[model samples]
Target chain A: MDTALSIGSAICLLLGSFLCLTGGIGILRFPDFYTRMHAVSVSETSAAGMILIGLMLQSPDGIVVIKLVMILLMVLFISPASSHALAQSAMRHGLKPWLSTTVPAIKNKHNETASDITSDKGVPPSNL
Target chain B: MIHTLYLSLTLAAFWLLNSGHYSPLILSLGAISIAFVVYLAHKMDVVDHEAQPVHLTLKLPGYYFWLTQQIILANISVVKHIWLGNKTITPTMTTVKSSQKTDMGKVIYANSITLTPGTIAVDLIGDQIIVHSLLSENIEALKAGEMDRRVRQLEH
Candidate 1:
């Protein structure tokens, strides 16, 4: 059981590290700032979450698991929020969307429907 | 009715689990602590119709599992781009009008959005939520309204 648990824990940690590494790669490789944000946000949350769960599983005592869970709760609470704030700041600062390679009749595909682009109302959509 | 009690019970269990040991004295102390916290929250008038759980059950595990999968896929996508070694991260921001009515609903929606990779909620103003994305593609995904639809389903 201990060996099985250790194996599980190791797998989780490896996956978590992989997630982080990929997120960084995404941040560096994505064509635009927005794309990078997508990578970082997704990878960070999952990697952290999986690693914690793995650690919790490996713990012999219930107390450690509970404490680890509390930590998980904290991650669930804060990381996304901070990411959201960062994205909002970037947009408010006038970051532009990337142009697509596909040459459709109408450029700025995002602008077709007001609702399709931005929320119901905020800033007008920038042409893609 | 049962759900609220269950939540309270869960909280109590968490407190006990974290505290360790199952002594009667400690159990009573934990109960008192939980009661005090709940009472204070109620006195603050934070408890209301929206405070109720809309989708309280085992299905939450499904959402968590799905979310984790999405995270993995997203991580892979991001990593691939990064390894390509081109400066491709483009940050884009936009406001989304939240369809959720209750405060808890909105909170859940916001939190869920954050949970997803590559998208972050900047600020939720009134009914509109401002979000930033690392990839403009993430914006396109959001425009698909998958997140909104799923989160709304979780709400009553």
Candidate 2:
């Protein structure tokens, strides 16, 4: 039983570390702020959840398990709300997203839905 | 009254679990603190169903199970895009309609959208949500209202 528990924990820890690494690389490689935020959410939700579950499994007693569960619940509930707020604030600041060519193509084909929202520049130069 | 009682019970449980002592002095202190908190909550007028959703206790486990599966699938999709390089990148912002009835339901729906890997819910105006996605496929799915239907069922 101990061996099975340890093995499961090891697997979960490894997977969590791998997901965090992927998210880090994504943050560095993605085009702009919104995409980077999305990448970070990958780490926040699944990666953090996997790591916490692994820790919970490795814990020996009920108190430790309860503490781990509390932490997990906080992460699951609070992280998404904060992310949504961040995205909303950014959008409210007039930071338009980089859309695909298809949106512009359709507009050009119709010539009626022509928008002032330009799509040429991939990402803003700097926000700082 | 029920909300206050439930809140106090929950606070007491949390206190007991956090404090490993069961002596008279410590127990009384814990009870006093819990009472003070309940009094404050009652004065603030924040003891409602959404604040203390005892009803969701039974429904949340199943919803969380389904959400976990969605999270895993989303992680896989996002990791693939991250590795495939930026030539395959396409970020789009669009608005989608929601069909939830209550404020809590709409908040849940929007948060679920943000919780998924590629999609972010930017703004919510009535039933419509402004969402930004790393992939068009994610947006297409949101626009289709499959997730909306599931969340509506959960809320109901």
Candidate 3:
């Protein structure tokens, strides 16, 4: 049981660390702000969750497990809220998301063209 | 009234969990603080169904289990795309219709979208949520509405 638990915890922690590393690479490699947020979200959600769960497995005290769960729950709630707020504010400020030219523009029910925003040239204003 | 009771119970649990000490003095202090906070919450008019959401307490665990699976799958996909580099990424922004009628339901739907690694819910207007995705397939999967249906089920 101890060996199994240790192996599981190690796997989780290693995976979590790898995810966090990818997120850092993604932040640097992604073309624009919006896409980078996706990378950060990956680290915040799964990576954080994995690390917490890994810690929970190693914790002998029930209270420690509960505390870890509380932290996980807090992260699960706060990360999305903050991400949405950031994305919304960026959209409100007219920060156009980068799109690959190969994919055709998708038209929603409102008939608003997302490609139109992507067509705008130059970098988004740094003041934001 | 039930909501208030649930709120107090939740507060008490939170206090006890955080305090960890069972001394009479600490216990009394915790009780007093919990009552004071609950009273303030009541006065603030935030002790209602939306605030407590006791109705969801039973249902949320199942939804969370499902959501955790989705998150893991999405995370793996995003990680692969990251390693493959930007050339393989098909960044797309499109709107998806949320079938939920209530604000809480819609919020859950939107948050689920945002919670997934490859996609983010950029904006929500009524039943429509503008979603940004790292891969076009992520958006396509969301358009299929499995997550939306699950959230709707959770709300009810």
DockQ of each: 0.39, 0.56, 0.77
Off by over 4 Å in 1: A21-43, A85-128, B1-7, B52-59, B95-98, B101-103
Candidate 3 accuracy as TM-score: 0.93
- Candidate 1: interface RMSD in Å? 4.5
Across all models, the iRMS values in order are 4.5, 2.4, 1.1
TM-score of each: 0.70, 0.90, 0.93
Residue-level lDDT for B28 in candidate 1: 90
Instruction: Give the TM-score between model 1's chain B and the true chain B.
Output: 0.77
Candidate topping DockQ: 3
The DockQ assigned to candidate 2 is 0.56
Q: Residue pairs in steric clash, candidate 3?
A: none
**CAPRI level of candidate 2:** medium
Question: What's the count of clashing pairs in each model shown?
Answer: 36, 0, 0
Please, what are the lDDT tens digits per residue for candidate 2 over residues B1-156?
889889999999999887888999999999999999998998998999999988777887888788888888988999889989776867777667899998888988899899888999988887777777888789888888878988888786
lDDT of 3 by residue, B1-156 (tens): 898789889888998997788999999999899889988998999988788888899999999899989998999999998889878888888889999989999998999999989999988886788888988899889989899999989887
